[model samples]
Target: MITKILQYYRGFVRARIVSHSPERFLNLCRNHQIILQDLVYRDGYYECQMDLKDFQRIRPIAHKSHTRLFILKKCGFPFFLYRNRHRKVTYISCALFVIVLYVMSLFIWDIQFEGNQKYTDDVLMTFLHSQGYVQGMKVHNVVCEDLEKAIRNEYEDINWVSARIDGTRLVVKIKENTGILEIEEKNYEEGDLIADKDGVVVSVITRKGTPMVHKGDTVSVGDVLVAGTLEILDDSGGVMAQHRVQADADIILERTYEYNDYIPATYIERNYIKERKHYFIQFFDYRFQIFPVEKKENTEIITTKNQCHLFSNFYIPVYYGSCQERIYEETEKSYTETEAKQLCERNLQYYFKNLKKLGVEIIQNNVTIKWDVNGCTANGTIVVHEKAGKLSQEQQVEETMKANEYH
Candidate 1:
């Protein structure tokens, strides 16, 4: 690839040789250290490509080998410049573009982040901006080591961070601490565990409190599942003393989620007519249109912009691309019964998928879809088993005690 690029930068040519001693001609050319590429022999003639400099030297060798050489084609940058020598404005514009790109390369144009899960791109970018490490800042102003350390310090979840400048882009890669961090257990005030939703109790495992509800019991929201107070019974079945503690337990419950959705029978569909192509160039905040675009009603404009870049990660502020104006007509349409049913089923499946994401185990789905002349309706319930318990301040209960019981 390097050699081909060098050849193009200098110049190259394809020449045809008609000689009886083709083997001798090749040997002489090799002896002179002239490299020939894509050599082919066809119909008693030899054709090959050589650099322009090598082509010039091959003339003497061709004479010595009693061969006739004819230049078939000229290629490469030198030839291109010579052909366009008369166009002064084109050359001047190209030179100015190169200068502009060189200037743009001195500053950061793009910021990219990778290997991020807990922190999103916007969040990370916002942090960087707060630290004065934003796009369009001078490349020299960015200290990679400082940026890496700052990120790791800012986000406790991120254990490792790598920041580097690739061309004009600043790339940051981070590895989040996936392992759960252990927290010191603190003595919490006495509280009771209550049901946050109406459900049937599936199971209860009391760790540090008295269980108030058993399995198969139907409970409503705000009902206490575990009591924070514990009572000590005497041999005669009398309350000897009472101990109050915070409730701690794992409780599972089966709950039902009502699902209801309806879709209108009529919808508007777009009918495409034709598209008009437009060209534009943008430099920083200013944009220039190559051609005038006529304003039309009921037309959608879709634009694509491409930033100027010399290589990967080396982006410039200048952007150029095309815009397509899509002309379309809206038509009113009605959904068929089959289509409505399918749409309703799709919505139902999507709801179930969201429920499963929240660690809810689906037990049963009793959804029914009905299609009528007006529209489609899906109404039913979904049964799921999920963890159920929320901490609530314990209600103080007054108890009568004799002074002798303390002794």
Candidate 2:
């Protein structure tokens, strides 16, 4: 039966062609032993169909002619089934996606905050959540302007703030308050300089206090410079009150450290592969299912969960992503002291380089220590060169240190 249908379709198949010269068209087809079927003459072209056999017969001449032909072929059932599968999935998925997107458009899945440096993300999110702008809330149910006004009224440290909905996450940007303290300058006092470390005196700069030593003066740790002359003969030939000042100086020292390590013969390593699967119900972004979700110990292995939403089409997610985690763990064997010291030295040098930025110059450095039967430990002292001047009280954020005042 299918063969007969195909034969009929082939016998009267429809097509179109263009030919400028009628005589040439007739001669060309005749030369190729082909027949013309259901011919038309309009717009310099013919519209018609032809049997495969007839078309093949004239195919040779048609190849040489300036004219062109287009044939309308019938679709077979296999072709129809194949196309229908794609169209069906697309149509059904699209239809479901639309309804789902509309419903999901009303709900919120995530919230985010940006442009916040002073406050942690958790803190900002907590504040936002208390304001009714949290995840899983209906997106269309809240007005963000009112929320911002409320937040500004509640938090004095915030100068300016704004909230926006980007897909499922609400991005809250904020500016923090910065104001200088109001203080009046007072009468000044002079102080002395004391040795912070055991080193040779290099040089000292006394702003208000008198200097005690010049360059190349050796000093022990805790030695004082710039004596506070309290009972001094003034120009009036009388004893005058002593004044305190800060004796500032730069001191550098040499230091050393070492590390010990033990080598292990075997090591343990862990590897992971990700398997992703997603399911939907009613083609909406309302709910989801994840397998093997039971919480357990040895969570050392971290599992990250990400969620995305689609408000436009169910098949294409438009919302930003979210992630949750589970921890994974692996232990590797240890190495010998030489290997450990190399590793420790690499890290130690990295840290020491940062300390140099604090204005301390290193005159010399040495590292000597190792761990074998037990863990490694190191011990060393720093020696710097600097001069001393009179000291004063320096007030700072944490604690106030007094120099000449201590004496």
Candidate 3:
């Protein structure tokens, strides 16, 4: 491979020689120190390859050997240049393109995360950016071990992490401790089951310990739903032996979430104008915005940035895009009753979505819309059924100390 590559750069030629005595021609060429390679004997001629300089020297030897020599092919940089001499501009552009690619390869252009179930891409990217790992950063400066250590230090749930560079892209792989319990859940193992929030218990099923609160019971935050005491009763319902354990129970509650929002009849509406100005520079994976834009008062600016890759998908160091700053002006606008109601409904729905994310199952949603002269007011009461119990570690410790003192 090395020899072939060097031959391409230094230039070489393939030629055939016909002689009455081929052995004599070969000996003459060797005696004159003319280098030859891949020599093959055909019906009446000897075919071989040699360096460009050797090819020039071969003619004199062929004359002495009384042989006929003809170039079968020319292969190398010199020949290539001669063949495309008229298209020098095209060749120079291609050379520049390769140089640009080399320069771009030195910088990191993309960051990717994998095996991340709990953390989001934005969350990981933001963390990476905060650690000086971002697009356009020098690839050499990135230390994968340092990044992995930093990530492990910052996120306790992550058990293992790996940061590696693939071309211009940085890939982060993480293995999180998904089986780990939450703080409240772990506390519950060592204490009585208490109410996490104020709610009406809809159902209660005790697995261990004694049930303190039954179904349809109203419990406040910190109130024990199940006691950790296990009582042993004799024939006459007399307490003989008692034991304390970690209480366990499944308590579903009907919790209500109230959200109040008022939408103004007259509000400022912002709209971006399509006119924009952009200036950008790109070489390989490097990108820079030449023109800096500012947001004017009472206006919103939207800047869109994009990077380009080679062959549409293959990432190279070359990037081409424009930052379009769409200037938006705000104007006073009045909302109709119907529009205000829709906005209020959207707000309520957004609140419900957030609740659902917490594993709350919505049993009923009651939203009351009040239309005032100025605007509309929406009051929402979302009744959700969800597990309702939390363990108070401090209280559990206090209770244990008190029981020890009493004993």
Query: What does the lDDT read for residue 297 in candidate 1?
Result: 91
- Per-residue lDDT value at 19 in model 1: 95
How many backbone collisions does model 1 have? 0
> What's the C-alpha lDDT at position 3 in model 3?
85
Candidate 2 deviant stretches above 4 angstroms: 1-202, 212-268, 273-287, 296-332, 336-338, 369-407
Tell me the deviation in Å of residue 74 in model 3. Answer: 3.7
User: lDDT rank, highest first?
Assistant: 1, 3, 2
> How many pairs of residues collide in each model?
0, 42, 4
Candidate 1: RMSD over Cα atoms?
10.9
Q: In candidate 2, how many Å is residue 287 off?
A: 7.3
Question: For residues 260-286, could you state the per-residue lDDT of candidate 1 as single tens digits?
Answer: 999889999999999889999988768
Q: Where is model 3 poorest over a 10-residue stretch in terms of lDDT?
A: 398-407
- Per-model TM against the reference: 0.53, 0.37, 0.63
lDDT of 2 by residue, 191-230 (tens): 4466655545555554434556566676666566554333
